[model samples]
Target: MSAPKVTVLDYGSGNVRSVVRALEHVGAEVTLSAKSQDVLNADGLVVPGVGAFAAVMKGLKDVDALRLIGRRVAGGRPVLGICVGLQILFDEGVEHGVRTAGMGEWPGKVERLQAEVVPHMGWNTVSPPEDSVLFNGIEDERFYFVHSYGVQHWDFDVSQPMMKPPQVTWSDHGGRFIAAVENGPLSATQFHPEKSGDAGAQLLRNWIGRLGKP
Candidate 1:
């Protein structure tokens, strides 16, 4: 079979090249583009972001990428968000006491980590749910993180019959916080899998493996 075609949304967010390179290394035909059709027609879409929450949201709006993301998820297409990309998937984000609205794919708020140390950097282990596809073989391995704010609490409750709850992964720095989330058609990570070396590569492969599955 041909490799999966994946689009890395190019909305002026830094650290995108590494994400593209990582996906390529994982056997995906990666394209870095902000074109509407490119974002919509790909087998998978990756939204990578760095720096501040408000700034990232602004950049996404500038490119009208948020609407495209919503449409993709609504149609049951797969999309992955990394770093600040993950943060903007929520209802809102509060950084440095400033509040910014998010895409609201999930209900929750992203806030500063309660830990004394800001910007939880370097390698850290994650706690993936048993059914997590993203952490398949790398369950006990560590991934790289570089952020000060994250969703400290999970507020989502599945109300539909036969609908499964999202698989949430956790990690620790000074306190426990959300490390990753796997909801149908939508997934995100607070860490940078592209920079996590072998473990991260395996995670990307795991995600890519499920690109067209029901």
Candidate 2:
């Protein structure tokens, strides 16, 4: 099969070059575009963020990406958010006592980690659920995390009889926080898979592999 067409949403949050390169290395026909057509037409969309929560939200708004992402997910198209990209998918984020509204896709808040160490940098292991496609064969592998804030809790109820529950992956820095989430067409990670080397590559591959599935 031909490489899956993936578009990396470029909204000026920075640190996107490495993400684009990583996707290309994983056999994806990647396009770094802010065009609405490009964002919605691709087989997969990647939202990469590397900055303060408020600023990232501002950038997304400037490019009209919030609506684009919502439309994609609503249509059952795939979307992957990285770092602050993941954080912005929630209800809101509080950084240094300032609260900013997020995309509100998930009902939660991103807050500063209650850890002794501020930025929880470096490699860390995660506990992915058995049905996770994102962590398929790399469950024991560690991914690179470089953030001080994350969604520390998950409160969304997926207990309806017909709907499948989301697969939540957990990791601990000062306490247990959401490391990754696989909820239908929406998936995200607090860590940077592009920078995680081989293990990260496999994780990205796993996600890319699910691009065209029904």
Candidate 3:
């Protein structure tokens, strides 16, 4: 019944500070992993992205980190991806670079926003992924978002879900990006939950509550 050990991957995305503070506030033994060793050993991991997709992927590659991350998650580690971090989980993204495949978790591609104005910033609505535990104790509402691209939707391997939920698969990362997607022990958020005020805090706290001791 003690706090969980959580690691926030700080790749210069700028939101790790608040996430770390918030997790610690919730009694989590939080560690900021800028080094590969820290990252590979984390009980739970958070991948934060605050810049362009190509650059972010390059940074992860520079350190050969995402494969290690994939290994951990594949081993049943609870992992979370936020914003751009969420987008890169797909098979590819078209931001600033050519068609580059992702870590291949979500099995989709990232693309530039269809919005006339790039960088879809501000508060936006996020639909819950039907019984998403990450949404426990939380009301469905608007969350802060600042991105030019998002997860182009993919059909979940329905045969494998512990539960099924409703979703819209737009050409743009499955119709929308919200809340978060659940694939095994992996949950990803395309919006910045850390900046979503009370709702955001509840979202994060719920996520920590769902983790197991490593």
Candidate 4:
């Protein structure tokens, strides 16, 4: 009954420490690192970033982390990304291009919400996706979200099989906007689960549960 090793990427993101603390709070043997090897060796990886996508992208590249991330996912290691980390998994980002282009795992664009004030920040409702391991224990769950740019055209790039992939579960926010997505061992969320308190802690547990190695 050994605790699982979970590595949280600390690529100079503002909330990396918070995410590590939260993961530890949920009993994960958390390792915080800016190193690619640490991520590659871990049983699971969590990428949490807050700030300009371009800067985050550069940080990842500086340490040669993106290649490791790609290899890890390809090699069957479970992975998760939060907030901007998830947003950049696509092809392009239109928010303050301090950093541009995505890791391109999922396809889409990140754009500022017009007609409404940018940077929607606060707690909002999340529609549960059936069989979502990330939503293992929750109801009427409202988590903290802070961002000006929201996802658009996610379904277009996401393969139909992947969109409905047996392993890919989703939490829908705006019918089309993907709040959370899971592909096999990899999962992501646009909300700050660590800042969301009890429910956030629950999310950590749920993802850990998917490791299948107790």
Lowest-sum lDDT 10-residue window in model 1: 155-164
Give the per-residue lDDT digits (tens) of candidate 3, residues 64-170: 77877887787888888888788888778886667776887766678776666667878876656455677765645667777878764566577756654434312
Using Cα atoms with residue i matched to residue i, what is each candidate's TM-score against the true structure? 0.98, 0.98, 0.85, 0.88
Candidate 1 local distance difference test against the native? 0.94
For candidate 1, lDDT tens digit of each residue in 1-214?
A: 9999999999999989999999999999999999999999999999999999999999999999999999999999999999998999999999878999999888889988889888798999999988789999899998999999999888787788787788899999888889999999999999999999999999999999999999
- Return the TM-score for candidate 4, rounded to 2 decimals: 0.88
Q: Candidate 3's error at 112, in angstroms?
A: 1.4
lDDT of each: 0.94, 0.94, 0.73, 0.77
- What residue pairs clash in candidate 3, if any at all? 91-102, 151-173, 152-173, 152-174, 153-173, 153-174, 169-174, 169-175, 170-174, 170-175
Question: Which tens-of-lDDT digit does each residue in 33-107 have in candidate 4?
Answer: 867678888888998979887887888888788988899888889889999888878777886544378987776
On lDDT, who's better, 2 or 4?
2
